[model samples]
Target: MPDTLEPVRIASKIMKINHAGEFGAINIYRAQIMVARLFSPQLVATLEDFLSHEQKHLEIFGRILQSRGIARCKSFWLCGIGGFCLGLITALMGRAGIMTCTAAVETVVTHHLLAQLASLEAENDSEAYQAVQSILSEVLEHQQHGIEQSKDSLLFKPVSAVVSCATSAVIWLGFQL
Candidate 1:
């Protein structure tokens, strides 16, 4: 590939990955909401709201990918499966687990989105830049909510570390495959 073409390729791939990640996010919230309805009814509304945002995000990326004639990342289904399982397991732990998972995943996601935005800017791809930029505020809000909800510093810190690391690993693998 020509050196100039490399950025486009990377940007395209990242967009696809971001789309797939949104799928994962949607599933996470879905699973959480499922459990929350029974155990944490107060949280159901919150989880549903986040899920709606993720749905919008997924649509944004999907539309962009379609316009560019790009397929979704191969990891899309894998992410959905992993997200559901992760959400189920965490929701079982109640608020702490749910918030920890959200905080950790969104932390990694926020960092990657910024990096991806920089790459898009370098490429001067306004469509991609705007797409990534649009979802950032909600993602940040979700992160902040998670951090606030998890009152137990002792549990939050350690569990969040583990979840964040795993989220990072998954992202790396997504870029690779």
Candidate 2:
């Protein structure tokens, strides 16, 4: 019989990819917040809080990547640039639009993290299982906060899917590049 280690390897790969993606998310939010401060100080402060949480998430995954000896994709630089560019564009779109973008990104990230957690559960990978559990909890907290904060806004349920799908597809392709 083939070793079950194969699934574990793939799981590790997913985890690393996820970690890199989280890093990109962090940078995107940071750029958005930076650009936001120019016109909307209060909103930028709010975004910064969630951005800090994402930074922590990135740290957790970075540790996991290091422990598993998983190297980040070389194309992650391109992904970062793409995320930064998206942030710049969103910022240019104005405060409401930026928050809408934030909500969209968080929603998709929450779903993706949940899926990764499910995969880890299926693999029964104890270490990765624990990591995913921790990370998902953190991500869910941010997701809930974003949803609540944006509930009455124009971005809550209206534009999240379209924006998220478009941005996520672009970012995913950026990683592949």
Candidate 3:
């Protein structure tokens, strides 16, 4: 049997990836908040709110990992460092750039979460299903917020495309590891 076909194993893998992703998201918001304060103080509060949400998500996934005796994804640090760097670079570009990054990341993430939810349902894993479902609305809200904030920027399309590609690559790598 394939490793991915086993429900518990797949669910654990998904949780580990989600945990790492949430941690990465926290660092991204942290870096954004730090840099954005200088150029866009008004955005700091919004970023903080998002960061808080990510923290809750991280804790949720962490508890699941603990209960299942599953370790976090090996890519945890990679995601953190990469997310921070991405956040810093985008934040340097100012409010539009940061918003673009947020929109891009959340767009990719929302889709991934939906896919995970479907997989969990198919596996009949009620715990994972509930967890994923619980966060879906919030994730969609984040994406919508980013879209609304960045829609007027001329750089939105190109920046979002690049960041979305990068986000997709990171997610793919996380699953592989």
Candidate 4:
């Protein structure tokens, strides 16, 4: 690809992956909420709030994709299904598991977003930079919330390591497609 086209391609791929990530996040929260209702009623509200945020993020990325005339990532369905399964399984493992999964996923996601922002800035891609900046704070918030929630758990470290690795793998695969 030409140098000028490289940034556009990168930005488009990032947006597509971001949109798909939000879709997966929404599904994950949805699955978590469903299971939480039965085992952790107190967490229902928090999960719902996070789900709403993910929904908004999804819309923001969707608009970016539309404006750029780029198609959504091919991994969208994979993300949704895989995320739901991960959520359901983690919820079955209880509160710590759920929060650990969030912390892990958000940790990887935040890192990716920061990397994207740096790349966008270097390329002077203001449009994509602004779009990414708008959501960066909330992504950090999600990561912090997950950490706080999982603080008292004995399994946090191990669960987080495993989940984070899986999240990283999925993100790498998404970008390759």
**Tens-place lDDT digits, model 3, residues 1-177:** 122334557798889999999988998999999998899999999999999999999999999999999999999999999999999989998999999999999999988887887778889899988888888888988999999999899989999998999888888888889
lDDT of each: 0.88, 0.68, 0.89, 0.88
Q: All candidates' TM-scores?
A: 0.94, 0.80, 0.95, 0.94
What digit string (tens of lDDT, one per residue) describes model 4 on residues 1-177? 111224557888888999999999999999999999999989899899999999999999999899889999999999999899989988988999999888889999888888888777877878888888998888889899999999689979888888888788788888789
Candidate 1 lDDT score at position 63 = 97
Q: Which has the better lDDT: candidate 2, or candidate 4?
A: 4
Query: Could you give me the TM-score of model 2 versus the true structure?
Result: 0.80
| Alpha-carbon deviation at 111 in model 4, angstroms | 0.7
| Residue 117, candidate 4: alpha-carbon lDDT | 83
User: Which is better, 1 or 3, measured by TM-score?
Assistant: 3
TM-score order of candidates, best first? 3, 1, 4, 2
Prediction 1 global C-alpha lDDT: 0.88
Clashing pairs in 1: none
Q: What is the lDDT of residue 151 in candidate 4?
A: 69
User: What root-mean-square deviation over C-alphas does model 4 reach?
Assistant: 3.1
Q: Which sections of candidate 3 miss by over 4 Å?
A: 1-8
Q: lDDT tens string, model 1, 1-177?
A: 111224748778878999999999999999999999999889998999999999999999999999999989999999999889889988998988999899999988998888887778888889989999999999999999998999565679888988788788778878888
- The candidate that achieves the highest TM-score relative to the unseen native structure: 3
